[model samples]
Target: MKRILLTGCAGFIGSNFVKTIASEQTDYEFDIIDALTYAGRKETIQEELNKHSFLQFHHLDIRDSSKIEKLFQERKYEGVIHFAAESHVDNSIKNPNIFVETNVLGTLNLLNASLKLFKENEAFRFVHVSTDEVYGQLTDDEPAFTEENQIKPSSPYSASKASSDLLVQSYYETFGLPTMITRCSNNYGPYQFPEKLIPVMIFKAQAKEKLPVYGDGKNIRDWIYVDDHNKGVWDVFLKGLAGEVYNLGGDSERRNIEVVNIILEHLGRSKELISYVTDRPGHDWRYAMDFSKARKELGWSPTVKFEEGIKKTIDWYLENKTWIEMVKGNNK
Candidate 1:
């Protein structure tokens, strides 16, 4: 069996990936590692953990180099799909050091370990998951950010991700290590942490609490479902050319206000609950993705539209209040 390592998988998109994609790969054995931070909750995947014979969970902080190396030596992983990071821009603003330590240094450790394995196996692959924010904000008239866009990150989170992306590329160029980077737009789906925009709106709107809208709420984001993004990631891992970068987009661009309004309308909440809050520093005005390369190269495009995906997401959060409470309680 082919053994693979998936880092930071107890969180949102990674958890969904484990549930849907990894579970379907019966020939592949997966070793999932997560720091189990406030956002990464093991409970989200407790059902799969109980029944999936091909899956293993490791309570690991990728920042610990020695421990990471030891695990790498033990597992002798043939592939790595790195999803670990301090992803929340707000949290990154509060403390940038952790983002650097975890996103940059932690990825560096993984690259070092994977290099040894790649040399031994000659077929090892390292796929780094990244965000479109690294390309910075886009204007209304500008063409969507493509794989060819230059890096110009505004927030600390995106900056750290860009740093990791560059480091991965350097390894491939210098050491001939097999690596691919997949940059995707915003993701929304079930099991998303309440701190994110979609979940935040859903939770607050249900409670009749004030819905915080940053700035004038016109900032736009291309919203890909987590499933679509993960599928594109898997395609890149399996079929994409080494040293290549791919962009995955949902093809659904919605303004921040539109997203909030959708949730409010769905929940039958009044617009009076909407509260305009001070925007965070370095908040990118807009983000759009042109994923033509991924489509042409891997035959991958998003299957879930925003409107349909949002309804499914909302229904899930409402149906799984127990899971929600469990995840929220851990953050305290």
Candidate 2:
């Protein structure tokens, strides 16, 4: 069986990717590594691991270079899908140091290990997962960001991601390490951390609490289902040209208020719960992606529509109260 190393398998998108691949592809065996940070929960993936004998889990932080190097030396992985990082924007605003350390330095450690291993193992590939926030804000009339757009990140979180993206591409350029980068729009689905917008609104609205909206709630984003995003990532990892960047989007553009209202409707809540708050510092006004490259080149596009995906997500959270409660309790 092909051996693959997957980082951040206990986090939201990472966990989803693990489940998707385990069910869709039977030829690969996976070794998942996660630190179980506030956003990373083992329960998110415990059931999947129980079902798949080929899946293994390790509790380790990527920032620990010694431990990371030792693991890479021990295992001969044919590929790596890196997803571990400090992703919350609010937390990054409060503390940027961890973002830089984990996203930038941690990525460097992975690249160094890959460099050494790839020299010996010619089949090794590295896929660096990133966010569309690395391109900064866009106006209503502006065309959606493509891979060629200059990086102008607005927040420390995005800046760290941009730094990591650059580092990954640099490895391919300077060291000839086989690498690919993927920048994706907003993702929402099951197992998402409660701190994100959709889940936060779902949790608060269920409790009949005020759902806070930043600014006038006019900030726009392109939302992609986690499953679709993960599928696109896997496609790119398998078929994309080395050193290329692919953007994945849902093609569903909606304002923040619209998203909140949709969640309210799905949960049978009221608009009266909507509370407009001060906008965040360096908040991007809009984010959209032209994923034609991914669609045309990789034969990948989003399969889930927002309307259907959001309802499914709401239902998942409603049905799996224990999972959300565990995540909330651990975060506290």
- Per-model TM-score, in order, reads 0.99, 0.98
Q: Any residue pairs clashing in model 2, and if so which?
A: none
Give the lDDT of residue 76 in candidate 1.
98
Whole-model alpha-carbon lDDT for candidate 1: 0.95
Tens digits of lDDT, candidate 2, 276-298: 99999999999999999999999
- For candidate 1, write residues 1-332 as lDDT tens digits: 99999998999999999999998897899999999999999888878888988899999999999999999999999999999998999999999999999999999999999998998999899999999999999987799998888999999999999999999999999999999999999999999989999999999999999999999999999999999999999999999999999999999999999999999999999999999999989889889999999999999999997999999999999999988898889553
Clashes of each: 0, 0
Query: Residue 310: error of model 1 in Å?
Result: 0.4
Model 2 root mean square deviation, Cα atoms: 1.1
Best by lDDT: 1
What TM-score does prediction 2 earn?
A: 0.98
CA lDDT of 273 in candidate 2?
99
- Pairs that collide in candidate 1 are none
